[model samples]
Target: MGPPAPGDADDGTGQRTGAVIVVAGVALFATALLAGAALAPDVGAAGDDASGTLVGSHGGGAGLHERGSVYLLDGREIAWRAGDTDSYFDVTKLDNGSVMAGFMQSGYDECGPYESPCAHTGFRIIDPNPDSGADPEITHEYSFPVRSEKNSEVHDVELLDSGEFLVTDMDRERIFTVRGDEITWQWNASQRYDAPEDPTRTDWLHINDVDVIGEDRYLVSVRNAHQLVVVARGEGVVEVINEGDPESTRGDPTLLRQQHNPQWLGNDSVLVADSHNDRIVELERGADGEWTVAWEIYAAEGVNFNWPRDADRLANGNTLITDSLNKRVVEVNRSGETVWSYNTPEVPYEAERLPEGETVGGTSYADGGGDTTTIGEGRDVPVLSFLLVIVQTAVQTPFWFTEVHVAVTLVSLVAVLVGLGSIIRARVRARR
Candidate 1:
């Protein structure tokens, strides 16, 4: 039969080869389509522009495989960069053209993982300018070591007027002030939450952030507990927001779910990056002492907020968001309209505008400001989410790469595999 005339198989060899080519073409097209969507301009970012520079701290993944950076963006481009360390979480501008960032790195001696040698976690005073255009110089640092870097590193630091830095030590489950080499004052979470024999080994109450809302008063974000506590120095926790979010006491996890970077809007109001809940929320405390979601936005510009780490209420009545997993920093009007946005270099942790910073408040959606429409209350797409985690470890994803795109890309891939199998079968049959 002369190998069935060399052209014949289950189907025709030529037909099978054509099918493979078609499938490969479709796969490439689908991939390019997702890439295009990612690089597209964010919706509503046109005439609504923004001015001034930005400073950011990116919390990179564990180990050196994915390192973080402390960066300064000049308008739309990066002006300077530093800390190719393991991760950086919080960064704030200092009066002297420098920056103070809460950071975590690897390789240290003495204490648990880095002591405060226990060497990786601590605060650093960095000069954003290096005359040679190299990595920014770390002028000074207050380092702390932890057992490991996961949930134990320092997350947030505030430079207080008294020259002491307010530090959030997740390993110790405490908020304290460190000036020079001494801890001036401290507040431990064990006093309020159930104590653990060894906090360094467990992901206990992750007290991730603290800010001086007023003299002698602080607003703290207890991430795992899903609440914010107002602590008055020496007086202990004066008022607990979201205390006992249980059915018995107040346990309303709906109010907050592992939130981060809350901005104190007023005595009765605060804006939170409701992280796990995938939204930016503003809470208002009533006369009865219960906090209610005054205003919240689930999605902006057609993309749902994913693991957003920080949201700041700017003085101009705009909200600046560090949308972490989405890998962009977005600024929205009081009504949650995207006024401006910048794609971050990686999975960023926090961002602050120069000059005004987040030191004050602007417009509050609690009272007025429309556009409070909630996008679909999102749920975790585990497979897509897992794929994204792996992809992001290697490259910065576009803000528009959502689950829909992931599903499309996956389907195209399966089709390509099927086509390859058809080609293999045809080749084998022809040989037989």
Candidate 2:
């Protein structure tokens, strides 16, 4: 509605049409996900229009190789219908074979036309019948009030088994849980987070991702704080399971700054996407609350992460990782060797492993530097534009331009009539 937040990147050198086409593909790729511990049915093989699967039975190399990454699985990557946008922020799968993708519009700092980008309010739901050819639609948009004011956004979404949802509000620096449509609980960093104000200003907790570690414990990633904070569920006590002080770290000091997503592996250990450090670290907590690194992937330089966002451990011990900036998903065995890999059609956010070996992921990108739209803002055009995508996917139509052209023609006809009426009135007045 108003001007988009500043500090957004828009070179304004690219073509609008090409950007839209690529954005559409990326949006579709973002909806796929990691099925639970069990393997998912091969929807792509069934010849369903909307169903697309990525099987990773390709590539090979023996040693702890780096250059020649092997793809051992035969994965299928299918394009979803048009207008399906993606995110690199959050991914939540529902019990009914549906998914809630956090971050409605991503990548762009500003908004305009089809290029409107917002924070985490936007989401897409995928049906169990992937072949139903139903395009995933974006809806149930949610955003924090202050975030919207400051142009901040949501970083992730977690679906609780109780049908509730938890989201990381980046701007507010807190975690919020939603029941039905209301915010049930929140943990604010400014007031409750324990930290020395002036000394650790650069390391102040910038809550990024949250995961349920136990009935009484929750794991959260604090980017700027440079720590994996373990907090009691529904309580205010926060303890650091990773780095404490910036000076006493084994690696770079910036590692504690702007850390990304974290996943709980078990009671005493967790996996974190240390984005700033360009690696994933497995941290273990001892009885005395001391933390140590158990194992780390790509900790040293020369590893391939561009900006890994989120990761999950599969039943078969494979780790499905979202390489956000690289626009790809890497599947690695327990030994940290690449077992399978899938390139995102565009920039991606989060990824998960499904019941079967297949992995679903969220793609992302910055939109144009023009008008960006959010929920309750922008012209009704985006609403209608998105609805058309739904119809096109449902009907399995190949030509979107044909449908748009007809709508434009009809609107132009009405404008012509209005103009003719005004011209006749001017003639009548001149005669008088």
Candidate 3:
């Protein structure tokens, strides 16, 4: 006949059939839930190897067209870049054909109580072309030391002709020049503008860029302030190019909202990536001393830009744009025609077209060594890692739990019931 009933047991002691199954189900359920959650992908983790070809019609002159590889801050991969720091903020091509980058890590106590929570922020100049089988050489390195109570993270760095470095200190609301380890010049935002409403606001000015416009003048993009300020090295603030109030966008073309990369385009005109406005505007100061939009590119003109963060005027009068949210870098001509484009696997913060004949990692692309061999078989979503991230985030920061976590939990519950049923049947058969 069939196996023994639930109550039957070889030891002569009747099994607690209901309790055993219930407990087994609960235990299995818990285990599966944790396992699944642990296996989920980590969204903050680095992305896979760069893949995809450059698209669009690449025309323009010998130097106007993008000849060399472009440098970018791959947002997704910066967190866990091997042998590197926590985050990559900016990447640019140095005059010596090297790559200069800014990186930062958090949760360090070296800066002490006066500084922000993050530490180990620094900039490095890397040799993109190294010997065969050799790693990229870091020729120059400088980590920000805690010199003042205003220790902050660096977002942008430019090597000055005088062998000095200009850097933006986000937390300190200042742009400072560093000669070796000492701060030679600095301009604090608080000294000129009102402090942000929130006293703890570290990114009040959100100074994203500091470009030397003239002998002693600097063009600064005060993102949070929704304006561009031109400051003299010693004389202090000189001009403020207001882009209107960030809260309300007026029809005035002069007003900017959350802009970045204000570069002098010559003839008293400025080219800015009007980020929040979803356009790139060329502002020109007329004889009336008022700034007006000379030209612009918007989605309505069949041009697609998703929160572009950086735009550089190329030698051929073309523009290289870092389409941040689109996860791509695009080069467009003066007529708003897309000439060249590279689609990244993750968000790209900035894109700098390297000088002619300059390449990174021996390739003129962002493929990180021209090895397009798919990493992890070209899987876009790390499902297993995401599950683990979800579980960990749920446990550590419950507020981070999302609908995906709920779905995983429900699936685990079903698995628990199935496990319990199988165990009950197997135990009954063994008793017989």
Give the winner by TM-score. 1
TM-score of 3: 0.59
Measured by lDDT, the strongest candidate is 1
Candidate 3 local lDDT, 167-242, one digit each (tens):
8876667889888889899998876677766433455666778887778778887887777888898888888776
Q: How far off is model 3, as Cα RMSD?
A: 13.8
- Taking all chains together, each candidate's TM-score versus the true structure is 0.80, 0.55, 0.59
Give the lowest summed-lDDT range of ten residues in model 3: 357-366
For model 1, residues 1-432, the per-residue Cα lDDT tens digits are 354653455658555675976677596757767676757655423333456545455644433225678887766767788856778888888778788888887767656433543446888888867466666889998986677777887888998889888999998899999889999999998777776899988997788999999898999998988988888899888888777644432346777888999998887788999987888898877777777777787777767888888988887778888888777788878666677787665688888877878774456666533223453466568788767655554555555666666677777777767777777777777667
Give me the overall lDDT of model 2.
0.48
Give the candidate order by descending lDDT.
1, 3, 2
Score candidate 1 by TM-score against the native: 0.80
Give the Cα error of residue 169 in candidate 3, in Å. 1.0
**Which parts of model 2 are misplaced by more than 4 Å?**
1-74, 79-88, 106-129, 144-151, 194-205, 246-257, 299-303, 356-432
Error of 3 at 424 (Å): 29
Across residues 319-399, which tens digit of lDDT does each residue of candidate 2 receive? 667654444576665556566565554445565555332222211111222221221111124344444334432332222
- Arrange candidates, best TM-score first: 1, 3, 2
Report, for every candidate in turn, its global Cα lDDT versus the true structure. 0.76, 0.48, 0.56
Error of 2 at 82 (Å): 7.2
